[model samples]
Target: MKDLFHKSLSRRSFLRYIAATMATTAVDWFKIEAMASTVEPKSDYPVVVIGAGIGGLVAATYLAKNGFPVTVIEQHDVPGGYVTSFERGEFKFDVAPHYTLGLSPFLEYLGIQEKVELVKPPEFFRVITPEHDLILPQEDPRGIIRVLSEKFPHEEQGIKSFMSLLNGLLQEWVKPFDMKTISSTHPIMWNLSKLNTAQVFDQHFKDPRLKAVLCIFGSGFGLPPSRLPALVFSPGTAASIYVGREYVKPCGQGFSNALMQAIENNRGRVILKTEVESILAKDGTVTGVRTTNGKTYTAKAVISNASAPATFEKMLSPGHVPDSYMAKLRTYRPSHSYFLVWLGLNKELRGKFKGFQNVVIPEHYDPEDDDKATSACNASKTRFQVYIYDALYSGYSKPGKSTVKILMQCGYRPWKHFEADYFAGKKEAYRKEKDRIAQILIERAESKVIPGLKSMIEVMDAATPLTHRRYTKNPEGAVLGYEHSMDNYWIYRNKNRTPIKGLYLASAWGSPGGGVNPVVRGGQSAFTDLMLDWAKIK
Candidate 1:
């Protein structure tokens, strides 16, 4: 890591590298479009997509628009897997995704931009630690540099260098790439990809507090800086600083609804409240899927947006997947889940907090220790992110009221004991445990960020890992799919294509891993690959 940092390239060399990568990306995009235009859709070549998550939805919409018959099957009553929202009395709360990046272009591509309203937070996010309270500016990299430089004057030059590196990484991330050669062609990116975020920070700064400040966003990927891939961390953090973060109006459900509507308008079908019992295959090739009600949907191909474990181990018949594939799958672990508390406050919190949409309060400056506490189920030592809905925009709740959500990274092992009973609908013990944890999180928030938070609550709801698993069907309720460590980086993980022909993956479980933005691109890439495959069938 030190060697790479010591040999930093000149600014001119960096620009030249970026330009080459962008040109390669443009060529790849044109190739995809040319292939897509040449493929003639067959009326009988129907496609079945399992799960109505953003990835599956985007893929189905593109296929349907391109003249192939498409059908989406979802187990939940709603369309969005984890992106849906719920109502509590007069207040509404988003289930997951407080704010998202790269949604505008995606929505516009689906032609539903007008239907969904995205509101930028007053600031990117507010970070609070024992020693400092800082607000990072939105869409202003120079402002961010100024703020951090002022806060940590001694590390100003280091901050500037780090930000410049992140900016370059962000440019690379947004463009297309020839995945086969990206590592070899982009040496800087390749070198940094081998190190964790913490290792990269050590090369630049001497202040632990500054490192902590820069790394708090790692929680968005469900890992601490010590374990998160520096390549993955750079693009996301840079996007937040330069492009800014936006919250969906009403809730994330509105965004999901827009995509669903786009699919329907394009003559696609979205089946809800129906579980896919198994993926039908004959002679080691996917045929279609069978629902829980014994209804069979025959198609030429199938795309599974379900968790990888469920897709390979449970959905398919035993021995259908190759032994080596299953062996590799076993080595990958799911990312951490969350313990969330959604509150419908009787009084508005906008004025009190000065209209801040998001606030992150860590227990201390050490993320590694905080991660350990999370894995150990120690709420006192864990950090939490608070989302104030009313603060983002007005009319989020009834007059004189507001909605807030508190979330913390939580391990699934502690909630395993309640899994059986919770699934069987006997949730007494599960509810008791969840309530206890919720109270601890609420009290921590009240003491650290919101004063008298408990008293203002009109309705309170808490969800455990079991709840997330039950709803999303992600094993252990892993929010970001597989752990995004250097060992399991995107390039090393499974891509959209699978060992079995005609069967594809489009979800957080697939390549270019999680986050609404990456998954959307994953969906598009899956559709592109599927279409290319079909074009060759003649």
Candidate 2:
């Protein structure tokens, strides 16, 4: 039956089904291919990249390989922004990313597949609620449908239909559709992009618990189903279930280090611990960037992987930015950040939850209420996502030990009071608040997910939203850049190309939005845009 299902629902049939469902006229097969051929340097024009994040690193590596002299400036000591790791005792904990999908293709394209090792978990995630405890299988869309159907037999048809829709959408997305031509080329996606996740789920399902269970991925984006755009949710969830999710073996730092090494191998330079003070512009065109150390590097173009607010409001003079662009930027809201608690257990947890990388325990089944509680920083009411790194990878911790991390979507407003002091090294008050919040999360996890969780700790560390802001320099410490709301949908958001000439955005704050996969694509897109523009120079 599974073999028959695969044969019946071919790519052509999927497209046909999607076209009929959306009532679109036709599906155009015009794909935007990246210019992979190398070009000789016409002039000594170099490119300056701000931020050494994954996006910037990807862009710089490609540009340098294609005969462009590239230099990346990063404020942090390490290259990876949020995709980094820290050591506590003998254990290493990933800073942000738990597991990522769609990164293998990027690593393969960049010829760094062998440099990094990716491990896929047995399951995508385990969702736990008061009423249901479900496991979403990894790389098995049909299994997901079957599992959910068995759980809620009444909504079986709806489950199949929704999963099928998602499978079709994933196909369209992986085709690497041109963002500019997506509306006309893929009308189904364009239409879906206009609606929220909840609207799409409501159309197919009747059970609120089923919808809630399916909406687990929404928390990863820091938005509930009611606000997260269908375009983001549909393909993201599909990819995790179908294409499969993977984690960089050891930690995310290895992934970042590999990319940085690739860039250096291609003659790109990365300067760490240097902040880009301003993006120098003349005659409304970006000329170069000046570091906070009073050093200036002249380049023909600049790609900023920094936050949108920092790029426009802090890094550039007001006169350089058009009022209209600033207005649109102001209207867009950044996504919620997170407060995390990392604990190193003296005893191994592999015997308890085998092969489970992530386990989400939600206090309430309703995602809307979860979002509200999270935004309010009410730890008791919000959900807790626990990551058992040791369960997935054997070497994640010391012998007979485990590394666990618990986090939830937390708003920046609640941590605003500690921002100034936190960065100034006067963390007395900040530490008190963060510790208090961490205790709440720890206590909740101890009672709900892991019994005697507190007693197993050998090392403990915590980070607040303020810590996120300081490390990544993101506005409000947004985890996923701008919120994936209808107001800030991909079509409405700023693309890789900016209003100012020779300036581009190549980070989560830019087009294609956030997540490890999208940001890697964003980096490639920014590089493609810059290369295309440079081609027009002579």
Candidate 3:
């Protein structure tokens, strides 16, 4: 009966049609308010954007500035994906540490730098272990080198050479997809150092302690250096010292404020709390999106920042997607998700170690051996990238207080250890698990840094994979989108626009490969395609 109704009206029935057995009115209204359209007339935006993430918002803002009408749809109640913050009795905590590294260049390009304030935190990242407690100072390469030299006096050359090569690599490594040349000789430096993270640390350094420290660095992305593509090692590591020792939004620049204000400024409409059940397609082409609340959004093109797998696997008709596209999609692995621990302290964690981040590496960590263990879930030891980011905004927390967010990556099997009933219910079930994990993080934090951290916490919270998917719409709640190695980084990255016509992809999985810079870079690639359509009318 439902199929008959769907096929009978075809185009006219598109505005509203559904299964009577399902509760259409019970759809998530918060989602609709975030992504739905409010304009009464069937107005068409030159570019229709889906998922108002960092990439989508940056693209939408630019297109609108050029006098193009735009509409952005998101599945969450808020616009910013990982670039967000929440409040608890005058205390606010960030879900993701999105400040510092990529914010300046990316935001400045959009001319919206003034829109969000970026402040430089005292330290970037700290490393604490039984052997060494390293403080990564701001841009003091000699100081850094001296510190490492003392740790591994015999392996000083290895440390110095590694940093030199990594620096040279980062400066020459930024080859966006748009760059036509990718030859080994492109950087054309008087001195060239080509050592993938694994090669440099493993081949040259023999000390287990030194190898553990360097290899453990890859744990920043929840993967070992051996698993990370060699090319990214340069920019990836150098970014921390060279680019990372910089600035970030205080309470986190509120990526939504940046995008929403741009929408209002450009006169673009943003709707929220609505759900898009499916993309109506005809003869392998996108016709429009059918909101669960009976609203439809249509245009010449649709840009989906939602997870590619979710869209093709669940949202679109299987008949419409070609077999080859389906095959390639299957080959692409969804990256691992995170088990995050969010915290709000009664008073600011002050003193020397305060306002610092710690990437705690477990004792006896090895590079070559760690990746395999982590992948197989045989990791007896682990590491964490800690961000001691307190209130960036003036009022997010009362004066003299701060908040810290700690992120660690793990397999879904941990939380999914039991039946669905274990965590199957409203958002509250997830919240309870959050409390469970929050204790672990705080306990671990106290052991690493403070003697009594549990007492320091006035407020505590946690977010699970379910929470990640609920907000980001990421498949399986993957954080860095797709996990890649040297073998997968190149061809594995899909083109900005897929074979799906009038539908473009602009998310972490799309291009540039996750993080703030890559998301916007991927968005620009899709926008280039959008400009071609705009040129037609001009």
Q: How would you encode candidate 1's per-residue C-alpha lDDT over 331-429 as one tens digit per residue?
A: 888989988899999997776785364445464678788788888777777878787777787777888998888988899999898888888999988
- Give the local distance difference test score of model 2: 0.79
- Ranked by TM-score from best down, the candidates are 1, 2, 3
- Per residue, candidate 2 scores C-alpha lDDT tens digits across 325-427 of 9998888899889889999999988767743644454645788888888888888888778888876766667789998898877998888887777778898
TM-score on alpha carbons, each prediction:
0.92, 0.91, 0.82
Which wins on lDDT, candidate 2 or candidate 3? 2
TM-score for predicted model 1 compared with the true structure: 0.92
Backbone clashes under 3 angstroms, per model: 0, 0, 19
Residue-wise lDDT of candidate 3 within 1-538, one digit each (tens)?
0121123333222212111101112233233222223322224545677777777786677666655678887777777788777777767777776644545544555566787676655654467867888876654556677787888899887777777665555434432222244454445221222334566566568787877776544554555665566555555556555544443555544656776788768877666676677877787678778777778877667777778887788778778888898887788777777777766676665553543567777765665454444443332355655666642334445666667777766665555543255346544555566676666666777788656667777776777766677677686677777765453454446766677777777777776567765676666666665554444433
Tell me, by TM-score, which candidate is best: 1
Report RMSD for candidate 3. 13.4
lDDT of 3: 0.62
Which consecutive 10 residues in model 2 have the weakest lDDT in total? 23-32
